[model samples]
Target: MPTGPKHQRFVFVEHNEEGQACGYEEDCRCMIGEDHDADASDESLNVNDAADIWLSKGMDEDYMFGFSEAQLRRAAGLS
Candidate 1:
C-alpha cells in the first residue's frame, strides 16, 4: 500500500523491456519477469471493492475510469 499524499503516490505499472505494458500483468497480478501460477489468484477485488479503494484515495463520487466498473473488474479477473 502507498502512504503518501493523495496525489503524490506513485502508481507502478509493469512494462516490458520495450517500455510498453506487458499485457499480462492484469491477468495474473504478477510483476514483470515473475512466473504466474495457474491457481495462485489472490487478487479478486471486484468493482465495489475498487470503488471503496478509490474512495479512500479521495476520488469524487462522480468520478469514473476509462472503463466502467464492471469492465474494470472483469479486467481484474473478478467478473
Candidate 2:
C-alpha cells in the first residue's frame, strides 16, 4: 500500500542548551519515550538542511506550523 503524505511522519527535533536542533526524535519524545537511545549522537542541524527536510516532508513554506524561518535557523544553530 502506498504510504500517505510525508508530512504525516513529522519527526521531532531535539534541542540543546542553546536552543539548537541537535538530532531527530523517532517517537516525539527523547530519552523518556519509546525507541529512546542514550548513546544517540546530538548532531547539529543546519538551516538549509532543515528547510529541505520540511519541504521534502510535504510542508508548505507559507503555511508551515508556528515555526518561522528565523526560528528554524536559530533552532538549527545557523543563526
Q: Which candidate is the best by TM-score?
A: 2
Cα lDDT tens digits, model 1, 1-79, are: 3232222222334333332332322322223223333464765444455555655556544543323555444444555
Worst 10 residues of 2 by lDDT: 1-10
Q: Model 1, clash count?
A: 0
lDDT of 2 by residue, 1-79 (tens): 4433222123555444454545443424232434344456677454455656666666567533435666555644557
| Candidate 2 Cα errors over 4 Å, as ranges | 1-40, 60-79
Deviation of model 2 at 49, angstroms? 0.2
Candidate models: Cα lDDT each: 0.41, 0.50
Pairs in steric clash, model 2 = none
Q: lDDT (0-100) at residue 49 of candidate 1?
A: 53
Q: How many angstroms is residue 25 displaced in model 1 relative to the true structure, after the best TM-score fit? A: 16
